[model samples]
Each structure stands twice: as structure tokens, then as C-alpha cells.
Target: MKILHTADWHLGQLFHEYDRTFEHQAFLNWLIETINSEEIEVLLVSGDVFDISNPSATSIKMLYTFLREATAQNSNLQIVITAGNHDSASRLEAPKPLLESSNIHIIGTIEKNSDGSINYEKLTIPLRNKLGEITIWCLAIPFLRMGDYPSVANASNPYSEGVTALYREAFEFAKTRMSDNQTIIAMGHMHTHHAEISDMDKTERLIMGGVECISATAFDSEMKYVALGHIHKAQRIGGKEHIRYSGSPLPMSFSERNYKHQVVIFELENEITSLKTLEIPVTIPLLRIPLKAEPLENVLVELQQLHDKNDFEQAPYLEIQVLLEEPEPALRYKIEEVLKYKNVRLARIQPYYPNKKESTSEFNQQELLHELQPVDVFTKSYQAKYSAEVPEHLMELFQQTLIDVNQTEA
Candidate 1:
């Protein structure tokens, strides 16, 4: 059996303010061609099919259109997709009945029995070859929320323990249904303690914290392969080659500009013989001009040189960083003037200033508390934690949040 593994599509994503529709479409087209040419029998999409829980209409259309077209082009192909943290479980699984007929299996939410127990049978999916013989079994486990798993009475860590118990129960049931030579593969959408994260990933950290992460030992040792999602960097878990994250197909942030996005392919002859990576071609490049903080004059010179290059259609998305001791009120305008008629699109402009001097004398708590306003208290608390004053942009955001809260109360 030949299988392709990929995850974190994040369709409908906006890079800064730029729409990524064309880039995502190009990737989907390339994937279709790769599937047909490679003669892959199975495709596993781990999670994060959409950028947000409420996706745009265009994103939904693109996803289904690609799936339908891919399955039609390859008659023997089987696809298994599970819901990620970014997906709305109920919404993603709404068309389960219709998609199943086309050999596409989606596991979004856990089903419950009348007695309020989980219906474990629904989690086990059998993958059969063209001749209608079962070759492998898949434990399709989607992203687990707080109340989704079984209750663990008197457990120190309820969430983590519940997750482990869920996998154990599902794997034990699958063991009974397996034949002598059949393989058992596991699918999951949560973070494992053994996985590595990319330097650029900000969202995954918010989704997968220390309290939410499960250990790699939660998976059964007998399983042939464990396909994981959530992490944007391609990596193996606990140095085990069979357990892996295929990563995102596109760079999610400017920090990931140097990352080589790819998908993993597994060829299982008897016990998973070969593994290979096929790099996804870059449809549009992301560039950080100067690559580091530089003076305003230096940045202007680089921008002028870039304009002279005259690379129009394929010009990369640009992020500019300016180093200054104080604020340059017209910095963006200056950069835009320099980039006039340049091919590149300005995605972001970041200004870095030296840290303010700290007070040498420490005041008593009583004196400080008496003089502080509500906003002052908040700023002091933030400075104590981060060791810096809140940026002007963030302070503006905080004021807006206060306004929103006041309106809600009113």
C-alpha cells in the first residue's frame, strides 16, 4: 500500500492583509497531479482544513471541489480526514453520508450512545484494497475537547488521562477486528510531547499547551504508523520514524520563509518499507528585506536596489524592519515612496527601538499602589512580566478592548 500524508492546509488564510486564494489553489492543483502520477492508494489529511472555524464560501468550495475531482481521477484512492483544532467539528462532518459514498471518510466529532457513553465502533475505519480485502485498520481520532472523552474519576490530570484512555479503548477495540497480517494505523489531531515545533509557529502554541499535550506513549506500540497533525513543521515523534507530522504545505509566517514545505509518502510492502518526501513548489515567495533590523537610510537604499531589479509578476511579499532610537512618524510613507512602482507588495513594516531606561530606585508598594490608575496598574503588571513597556499598537488595542467591554456591560 502506498500512502501520502499532509496536514494544516489552513485554507482561507490571510497573510497580513493579502488573500492567499491563488496560492492555495495552485497547491491543490499540484497535489492532484502528484496523486495521479504517484499512483497513491491512500491519502491522509491530518487537520486544520480551514484557517478558522467559520470559513469563507470560496474556501469551502475549493476544498470539496478538489476532493471530488481527485477521487474521480483515481478510482482506487481512499482519503481519511479528521477535524483539527481550527475546524468546527459539526460543520466539517455535516456531509458525512454523502462523502462516504465517494470513498472519503471524515471523522470530526465523537458519537455518543443513548446511555451517554462513547460509540467506539464509529472511530475504527477499515481500509481495504481494490479487491475488497482488508489491508489495514485506521483509528480516526479527531481533536478532543474537554467533555469529549470519558470521565476519569479521581485522576490527578483529568484531561491528559482522559485522552490516553480514549486512545487505549479505541486501539483495544481495533485489536479485536484485526486479522493476522493486517496493519493498524493511528490518526490524531492533538499535540504529542515528542513533536518539534517550528520557530515561526505562534498559533499552535496557543492551541497546544503543556496542559493539553499528550505523551507519545499514549499510542499503541503495535501500530504500524501514526499520522499526526497540528504542528506546522515536518518531524518524527520521539525519534520514531513511523510516527510523524507532515507539516503545512505553505509558509504560515515570515519566520518560516526558509522552511521547505513538503508532504511525506509511505510505501507499505509488508511492514512499512519505504518513506519519502516530495517538496511542494513555492507558488509565491516571502521575503524580508535586509533580513534583519537596519537603519532607515540602509533600508531605503535596499528598496531602491530592489526596484531597479524590475522583477514584476513574481516579486516576493516584503516585510521591512527599521531600527531607530525613537519613533519615525513618517517611516511607512517614506518606504512606500521608495517602493513606488516596485513589483513587491508591502505586507508589514516593523520598527525596533532601544529599550527605555529602568528606574534605579524602587518605590514602596504602598506609595506605588496609591498613585496608580487602572490603566497604570495594568501597564505596571505587564512591564513586570515582560520587562518592557507595552507597544503603542498594543496599548491602542487595549483601549479598544476596554471600550468593547464597557459597551457590553451597558
Candidate 2:
């Protein structure tokens, strides 16, 4: 059986203040072609199908349109998608009855039985071969929230212990329904302790509680392959080749402009699996000015030289980093005027100034009001309110909230 894994689509996402309908549509189109060409029998999307729990009508349309087109192009293909933290569980699974007939399975939340017990049967999905015989059983687990995992009394790390227990139980349950020759695989949307994060961007920040990162040992070693999500960089978990994150297909932020956005494809035969990655073609480019923070005078020259590559219909997104001796109030206006006729969208203007004598905690009210960023403000407020440095998960939540607000306001 051949399986393709991808995640973090963030459909209907806006880059800077600009709509990304074009880029997303282009990707969906390319994905359909890849499905047809690769002869893939199954597709697994780990999570974060939408940028927010409540998505725009246009964004919702794009997803359904892609699904209809994809299934039409490949009749034998089966797609399994799970909801991430950004998705409203019920909303993503609302169309389940209508979609299952077409070989599309959407697992949004953990379903419980009338007796208040976790329904393991619903969590386990059977992967069938071309001959309509079940050859693999996939434990399709979504982004687990509070109360979703089993309660372990007096556990030091409740969230981590709960998650580990849930998976252990799920895996054990699958063993009963599986044949001796059938393979067992799993899917998850989480942050493992051994994962590496590209700290360059705030777009992929994922945190649920004070302690959300779990041990990679959450999954039993007996599982053949584990497809993961929630991190944007494609990488293997620890040293395990079969455990991996396929990453986002588009750059989530300017810091990730150079990330080789891709999807993972692997073929499983006779309990052995082989992995390969296919890079997604960039529909629109993301460019940085001067490659480093520089004086405005130098950055201007680079922008002027980029006029030759300008395309009004499909202009590249640009992020300018300016090193300043003093505040340049007209910096934005100047760049706007320079790019008036050029084919580029000014996304961000990052300014770096010389270090001040006062530390971040020493900033006055006036300075805090005008000089600090939303993140800085969030840090100060969280410290004042909680009387401690902000937890990484809280900061991640604040960052994710800020991104959502910015996208909405834009």
C-alpha cells in the first residue's frame, strides 16, 4: 500500500494583509496532479486543515472543492483527515456521513459511548488493499484537548501522562481487531519533546497547557509508521525513521521563506516501509531585502534592482529589515513610494535599533506604549498578572491569537 502524508494547510490563510486564495488554489491543483501521478491509494492529513476554528465561506468552499476534485480524479484513493487545535472538532466532522461513502474519513474529536467510555472502534480505521481486503489498521487520533485523554491520578505531568495512556490504550485495542499479518500504523497532531522547532516564525506556535510537549515514547515501538503534525518543519522524531512530520506546504512566515515545503510519500509492503519527499513548487516567491538588516539607504538600492523581476499580476512578497540609528518615521512612506510602480507587495518592515541601557523590565509606560511589540506587551502583561515569566505554551497561544487577529483585521 502506498500512503502520502501532508499537514498544516491553513486554508484561507492570508499572508501579511494579502489574500492567499491564489496560492492555496494553485497548491490544491498541483496536489490533485500529484495524487494522479503517484498512484497513491491513501492520503493522511494530520491536522490544522483551516487557519481558524471559524473559517470564511470562501475558505470552506476551497476545501470542499479540492476534496470533490481530488476524489473525482482518482476513484480508488482514500483520504483520512484529522482536526487540529485550529479546527472546531464538530465543524470538521459535520460532513462525515456525506463524505464516508466516497472513501473520505474525517476524525475531529474522540467519540464516547453512551456508557461514557471512549469508543475505540470509531478511532481505529481500516486500510484496505486494491482487492478490498484490510491490510492495515490506522489509529487516527486528532489534536487532543483537556479531558480528552485518560485520567491518571496524582500524575506529575498530567497532560503528558494522559496522552501516553490514551495512545497505549488505543494501540492495545487495535491489536484485538487486527489480523496477524496486518500492519498497525498511527497518526497524531502533537508536540513531542524530541522535536526541533524553527524559532524564526510565530505562525506555527502550538501550545495547549503549561506542559504540552510529550515524550516520543507516547507511541509504542511496535507501530510500523507514525505520521505527525503540529510542527511546520519536516523532520524525523528522535532517531526513528518511521516517525516523522511532513511539515507545511507553504512558508508560514518570512523567517521560513527558505524552508523546502514538501509532502512525504512512503510505500508499505510486507511490513517494510520506504520514505521519500516531494517538494511543492512555489506559486509565488517570498523575498527578503539585502538578506540581512541594513541601513535604509542600502536597502533602497536592492529594492530598485528588483524592478526587473516585478510582476504586477503575481508580485513576490517582500520583507524588509532596516537597521536604524534613530526612528525613521517616514520609512514606511518612503518604501511605499519606491514600490508604487514595482511589482512587489510590502509585507513587513522590521527595524533593528542599538541596544538601550534600560532592560525590558525597566521600560516606562510611555516606552512600553510605543516601542514594544504585541509580543513584548504580552510578556509584560503576563508577568504582571501571573507574577512569573510567561510559559511557552501561553506565549504560543498569544502568538497564535495575534496572528488570527491580524489576519482578520487585514
Candidate 3:
């Protein structure tokens, strides 16, 4: 049985603020072509089908078109999909019944029967030939899905223990459902093992509950191969045997500039016969140039040092960190001109004093406090003294009184 393990599709994703629709379209085309050429039996999309919880209508259409084309091309091809935290399980599972009729199995969340047994949850996709049957047990462990298990709500100690226990129960149930002679191939979207993380991913995780790191040993015993998603980088976990993460199809962030997007292909003869990684070509070139400048002249000199000087005129997306004693409007103007390298985007302006090491974690706490403009010293003193819950309207009145007192004091 030949299966193509790909995950973290992140459809409708944006690279920086740039629309990735065109690049996504190109990638979809490439994926379809590869499927056709490879004569793949199963296309396993581990998770993160959509980049956002609520995707645009156009994004939905793109997915529909891709599915239609794929199903039409290969009557035998089976597509299995699950939802990552980025996607709403309900939204992703909307067309589940309809899609299943077309040989596509969508497991947005774990489904358990009253008997506590995995039913249709373990997709026993058959690879039939004259020799016998080789079945792949498609196990979908959705991201942030707590409905399947009862033990994971606001638990004491590390939440991972609860998560691990839930999966163990689920995996134990899934194992019983799979055909004994057939090989089991499990799929999920989550973090596993220690690995290098991208800057953009790090930023996004901050807003989302970044508490996710599962040991690979959880699935090591039951399944022959485990295909994971979530993490953007393609990696081998659990001692690099059959467990692996097929990274996102494209670079979703500038921090992933160094990562080459790819998918994993496995040839199975009971156990995985052969496995190979395929790289997806970038539809558009992504160039990130960090220019540090204390003065306008220094900025220009650094810009000249870039390999493609014309890239400035191209308005390439950029992150500029400036360390200056005094950054003037004039300097900003000259920097903009030099940045006229085509499509040059000023991502960030990080100003620092000369001979001072910048503390990346520290922020201007005093400025934030002053911006609040506490009314009078008495009002501030009152706030500090009180710990009682105030009503919304009362809070508003208090804020206004404080502002007035602050103005009066000024």
C-alpha cells in the first residue's frame, strides 16, 4: 500500500500580510499532479486544514475545488482529514457525510461509541490486491479536542499528563478496531519532541495556549507509522523509524524562511517498505533582509551589501531593526528611499542607544502606566487600596473621575 503523509496544509494562510491565494493555488495543482503520478492510495492530511477558524468564502471554494479534482482524477484515492487548533472542528466537519460518500473521511474530532469502542473513528482504509488486504488504520486525534475525553478540564499539575492519559485511552480503543493482519498508520496534529521553532510560530503560539508537547512513545507501540502535524518544520521523532512530521506545504511566516516545505511518501509491505521526503517549490521567492542602522549613511551602506540590490526597488518584505543615538525624520526618509528596493517593506524599527545591549523581553512599563493617566494621587491610592469587584458602569465612572483628577493635577 502506498500512502502520502502530508499535514499542516494551513489553507487560506497568509505569509506576513501578503495574500497567499495564488501560491496556495499553485501548491494545490502541484499536489494533485503528484497524487496522480504517484498512484497514491491514501492522502493523509493530519490537521490544520484552514489557517483560521473562520476562513473566507474564497478559501472554502479553493478547498472544494481541490477535493473535487482529486476525487475525479483517482476513483480509488481516499483523503483523510482532521482539524487542528487553528480550525473550528464544527466548521471543518460541516460537509463530512457528503465528503465521505466520495471516499474522503473527515475526522474533525475523536468519536467514541456508548461501549467506549472506536467505531468509524478508526478508518480501516483497505489496500486490496490479489495477495490479500493491507489496511491502514486512520486515527484522527484533533487539536484541542476535549470532548472525547472526560479527564482534561482545568486539571492540577501539568495539563500534558491529562492529555497523555486521554490519548492513551483513545489509542487503546483504536487498536482493538484495527484488522490484526493490516498495518496501522495513525495521524494527529500536535507538538512532539524538542526541535528548533520559527520566530513567527513562536509569536502566534503566545496568543494561543502554547501548552502542547506529547511524547512520541504514546503511539510508538500501537502503530506501524505515525504522521504528525502542527509543527511547521518536517522532522523525525521517536528515534526516526516510522514516526515523522511532514511540515507545512508552504512557508506561512518569514521566520520559516530557512524551512523547506515538504511531504512524506511511504511504501508499505506490512511495515513501511520505503519512505521519502518530497519538497514543495515556493511559488514566489521570499527574501528577508535585516538591516541594522544607527545613521542614514550606515543604513545605505548595509543595504548595498545585500546580494540583490534591486530587491529594495522590488518592495520585498523586510524587518529593519535600527539602533540609533537619535533617529531623525530625515534619516527615516533616506532609509525609505534606499528601501525603494522593489517591494521593500519595513517590518519593524527597533531603536537602541549606542554601546547598550538591548533586553528583548523588557518593555516600557512606565510609559504604559503613564499613558493610563491616573486621576489624582488619591484616586490611584484608592485603586491600590481596593480589591473589590467593581461593576462595568462603575468602573467607567471611576476611570472618568480618575482622568478628570489627573487633568486637574496637570
- Pairs that collide, model 2: none
Per-residue C-alpha lDDT of model 2 across residues 1-410, encoded as one tens digit per residue = 99999998999788997899899989989888999899989999999999999999999999999999888988888899999988899999999989867889999999888987788888899998899999888999999998888899999888889999999999999999988679888999988876766763233465654388878888998898899988888889978888899998888788678788999999986565678999999988998887889999998877887775445557889999988765566999998878887778889998875443334453444574777798888787655443456767767988899999999999
Q: Model 2 residue 330 lDDT?
A: 96
Greater-lDDT candidate between 2 and 3: 2
* Distance from true location, Cα of 2 in model 1, Å: 0.5
Candidate 1 segments exceeding 4 Å error: 307-314, 356-410
Best by TM-score: 1
- Per-residue accuracy of model 3 over 1-410 as CA lDDT, tens digit each: 78898887777876556677887888899999999998887788888888999999989999889999998998778788878878888888889878755778777766667886544444444444334454655556677454454464566524455557656665665667666666666777777757446775676643326555667766747577888888888888867668888888887766676797998898875778878988998766555444334554565677666554443433445655555544244655666777664355555454544644333221223335545544443344433333223345655887888788789999
List runs of model 2 lying over 4 Å from the truth.
200-204, 208-210, 308-310, 356-410
- Given candidate 1, what's the lDDT at residue 274? 75
Write the number of the candidate with greater TM-score, choosing between 2 and 3. Answer: 2
Model 3 earns a TM-score of: 0.77
> In terms of TM-score, which candidate is stronger, 1 or 2?
1
Each prediction's whole-model lDDT (CA) = 0.85, 0.85, 0.69
| Per-model TM-score on C-alpha atoms | 0.87, 0.86, 0.77
